[model samples]
Target: MWCWLYFYIFLVISQILYFSSLFFLFKVMDVFIEFQILCFNSVNVEMAVFLDWVSLMFSSFVFLISSMIILYSKSYMVKDKNLDRFVYIMVLFVLSMMVVIMSSNLVFVLLGWDGLGLVSYILVIYYQNIKSYNAGMLTALSNRVGDSALLVGIALMMGLGGWGYSSYMGDFFLDMNLIMFSVLIVLASFTKSAQIPFSSWLPAAMAAPTPVSALVHSSTLVTAGVYLLFRFSNLLSRESFMVFMYLSLFTMFMAGLAANFEFDLKKVIALSTLSQLGMMMVIFFLGSEDLAFFHLLMHALFKALLFMCAGVIIHSVGGCQDIRYMGGLVQAFPISSACFGVSSLALCGLPFLSGFYSKDLVVEVFSMSGMGLFIYLMFFFSVGLTVSYSMRLLIYVFIGQFNVLSLINLNEKDSSLMLKSMMFLLVLVIFKGSILGWMSFSTPYFIVLPFSMKLMTLLMILFGSLFGLDVLFSGVGQSSSMFGFIHFSLFVSGMWNLPVLSTSSLNSFTLNLGKLYLKNMEFGWAEFYGSKGGFNLISMILYEGLSVIRNHLKIYLLLMWGFLVFIVLLAIV
Candidate 1:
C-alpha cells in the first residue's frame, strides 16, 4: 500500500516535471545526453538518452497511466496471495517501457523491448493454471518473432555505422540498405503490435490479471511497435508503405468483427485494443506520425480506463468473463458502468472526448489526402464496424437482460481501489485530448469538405451502431440454438477463424505432426535401429559370427570373387 502511494507520488511529480520541461525548457533547447561505455576498433558503444518534447510527453503519459494501473491492481488483485509479486512485475514492466520511451539508442530500446515481452509473459501466466501457461506461451512465442526481427534490424542498422537512432534520423534516405532496414523494422513492429497473424496472442494474453491487461494492452507493450514505427517513419516510407497500410486496415476490420461476435468480456476489450492498434498504425502510415502519436497517447488514456472499468464489472460478476452472463451491471456498479460507457464512447470516437480529438484529426487528414477509394472505404467501414461492436458490447453489458446467477454476490461495496484509479483515468480520458492536442501540435489542420464527405464518419458510425444493436439485441452475445448462422458467425466473429488459425488450429496441426514424427521417426525408426534393439542385434551378430558366416559363405565367396574381378579390371586399366 505504501509502495503504491510512493510510486504514485513519484509519477505525479514526474509528469509535472515533464510538462514543465516540454513547455519551458524544451522550448529553448532539447536534451541529449550520452555516456560512452565501450570502444572497439574505433567503434563507440554508448548509452544515450534523448529527451525532447516527444519523449517527455510520452514518458509522462506512460507514467500517468502506470500509476493508475498500479493503484487499480491494488483492488483487482486484493484476493491474490501474490500481490507484491504482481506489483513488482508491473513496476518492472513500466520501467522497461520508460527505457523504451527515453532511449535514443536502438540497443537500449531492445533491452526495454525484450523486457516488456518477458515481463508480460510472466504476468500472463501469473495465475499458474494450464490455461494461463498456454496463453503465456502463445504470447511469448508470438512476441519472440518480433524480437528476432528487431535483432536483425539492429544488425542491419549497424551496417550504417552506428546504433543510435538520433544520428541516423535525417539520413534515412541515404542509407544503402533502406529497404531491408525498413522491412525488418516494420516486421518487428508488426509482431510487437499484434498485427495480422501475430494478432492472436493479444487476445490470448487476456488470461493474465486484469491490471496486467490494462497495463500491457493500454500504453506500454503493444504501443511499443507503433512507437518504433513512428520513430522510424522516415525510414519506412519507400516501397513497403502500402503494405503496412493494408495490414493495418485488415487488422482493424478483423478485430471489429471478432469483438462483435465475442461473448467473453475481456476478449472483446482485447480485440478492441487490437483494432485500435491498427487505427494508430494506419494513422502513422498516412504521413502524420505526430497525429498518430497523438492518438497513441489518447488511446492509452481511454483504453486503460475501458479495461479497468471492465475489470470492475468482471469482479462484480464474481469472475464471470462471459458478457452473456452479465447484464444490468449498471444498476449495481454505476460508477464502473459510467466509466465503461464513457471509455467505450471515447473508443468509438465520440466528439470532444480524448479519442475524438485524435480520431477526428486522423479521418480529416485522410479525407484531405486525396487517397484512393480503397483507403477511404477501409477506414470508414472499420469505423462503422467499431461502432457496431461497441454498441453490441453495451447491449450485452448494460442494457440487456440481467443474466447473472441469482446467488452471485453482485454488490457495489469495496470499489475504492478500482474507483480511485478509474476516477483518475476518467479525468484524463475526458480532458487529455484538449490538453495534449494543445501541447503536442501548434498548427490546426485545415480540412474543407463537401456535405456528404463531412457526414461520412457520422453516417458510418450510425449505420454500424444500428447494425450492431439490431443483431446483438436479437441475442448474439447470448447463447442460441441457431445453428444455421453458426458458421457465418464463427467466420466473422472469430476474425474469419484468425485467432484459431494462428493459435489453436495451427497448434493442433503442429502438435499432431510432431506426434506423427515421434511415432514414425524418432520413436519408430531411430528407436528400432539406433537403440537397444539395434544394440542387441549387433551383439547377436557378433556372438554368432561363425554360424552367420557359414550360412552366408556362398554369398561371401561370390562377393570376394566379384571384388577380385573388379580389382583386376582396375589394375589392368
Candidate 2:
C-alpha cells in the first residue's frame, strides 16, 4: 500500500549520497563525463548521458524535493482512489526532469522537454474540472511556443554537425546559424520560464494539485527553462542578453506587483514564483550564471516548502483558497503557520534565511556591475515588490481576522506526514543557502560598496512591508472611491490584462477564423463543389439525357423519313 513512499525514501537516500560525493568531486576537479549510445559518420544520433557537478547537484535537488513531495502527498491525497496513478505520474514527472538534467544532446533534451510539457498538461487537468481544463489549455499553448523554438534550434544544430551543445560552449561561432540558434534558445527559455506574455499560464496552472504546483513551479517545469539557459549561457549573443535583460526585469516587476494585488492564496505564490524566475533570468542575462543557479537551488528548497505549507492551510480551511476568508491561522494551525511564515520571509530574502544569501549576493554583484540607472533602479524596485507581496500574503493569511465558520477543524497534527515533509524542508529553508553558497563558489565574492548602497536591500524590504500594510488598510471602508480602487485592483491583479491578451484577445481572432473556416470551407465550398454538388450535377445531366432521348425518338423518325425522300429525289435529279 505504501510502495510509492518506500521508492521515494530510497531515492532521497541515493540523492543525498550522490550530492555529497559530487560536491567534493566538483571541488577537487571539473567533472564532465559523456556516454554515447549511438554514433554515425560525423553525426551523432545516439542518446547520451552528460554528468558533471552542476547536473548532478541539480538532479540531487530534484530527487530530494520530489521525494519530499511524494511523501507529503501520501497524507495530502490519501482519500483519492487513484493514488497509484498519481504516484506513477509523479514518478514520470521526476524521471523527465532527470532526463533533461542528464542529457547533453538536444535530441534527448527535446524528448525530456516534451515529456515535461506533456506530463504537465496531464497533471494540470488531473482534477477534470472546467478550470483545470482551461488552465491546462493555457499551459499547453504557452509552452508550445517554446517547443517550436527548441525544434527550430534542433534544425539549426544540424548545420553545426552535432547535437551536443556542451562541446560548442565558449567557442561562439559568429555566424548566422549560431546567432539564430542562440536567439531561438532564449525564446524557448522565455516561454518555458513564463516570461512576459507567457506569464498568465503560471498563475492559471494553480488549478493543479498543490503538490504538483510545488513540483512544477520549484524544480521541474518552470525551472527547466532556467536550467536550459544555464547550460547554453555561452552560446547566447550579447545583443540577446541586452534585449532580454529588460524583458526579464519587466517580468519580475510585473509579477511582484500582481502578487500584491492578488487575493487568491495559491496564485499569489504562483506569481511570486514567476517573479523569482524572472529574477533568475535577468541575473543570468546580466553576466552571473553562477549566482542565478545558486538562487535557483535556494529558491526550489523554500518555494516547494512554501507551497506545501499553503496546501496544509488550504486543506484545513476546507478547500477555500481565498485569503480574504482566512485570518489568524497562526492560532489554529501553529506548525503550518510557522512554516508558512518562515517560507514567506525566505521569499522576501530576510537576513540569515536561505533566500537572503543568494538574493544579497545578487544585489552586491549587480551594484558592482556598471549597469545603467534603469537597470539598477528597476532591479531594487522589483526586490521591494517581492517583499511587498510576501508581506501582503502573510498579513492576509496569518494576521487578519478569521472569516470562516467556527465549526471547521483547523488541526495541523492530524496531517503528520505533511507536517514531517514540511519540517524537513523547513530546516533547509533556514540554512541551505549558506551551505550551498560555501560549496558552489570556491572563493568568496568580496563586494566593496558605500554604506548607503549596502543598506539598500534592507531599506527596500522595510519600505515594501510598509507599502503592503498601507495597501491592506487602504481599501477597508472607502465606499466613495471604491469604484476607482476596484478598477485599479482589477487592472493590476489581472496582470495588466495579460490573461485576456493570452486567452481572450488571441482566442477571439482565432475562434472567428475557425468559424469562417467552418462556414466557407466545410459548409459553402464543400457543399457546392464536393459530393453534394457532384450528385446534383450528375442527376441533372441524367434527367436531361433521359428527357432528350424520349422527346427525340418521336421527332427523329419523322425527320429521318422526310430526309430519306429528299435524298432520293436529289440522287435521281
Total backbone collisions for each predicted model: 0, 0
Residues 212-258, candidate 1: write the lDDT tens digits: 89888888999999998887776674678778888888999889877
Off by over 4 Å in 2: 6-10, 13-42, 170-174, 476-487, 525-573
Residues 71-126, candidate 2: write the lDDT tens digits.
Answer: 88888898889988998898899889888988888888999999999999999999
Model 1: colliding residue pairs: none
**What Cα-based lDDT does every candidate model obtain?**
0.83, 0.86
Cα-based TM-score, every candidate: 0.87, 0.89
lDDT of 2 at 532: 84
Best by TM-score: 2
Worst 10 residues of 1 by lDDT: 477-486
User: Every model's Cα RMSD, please?
Assistant: 8.3, 5.3
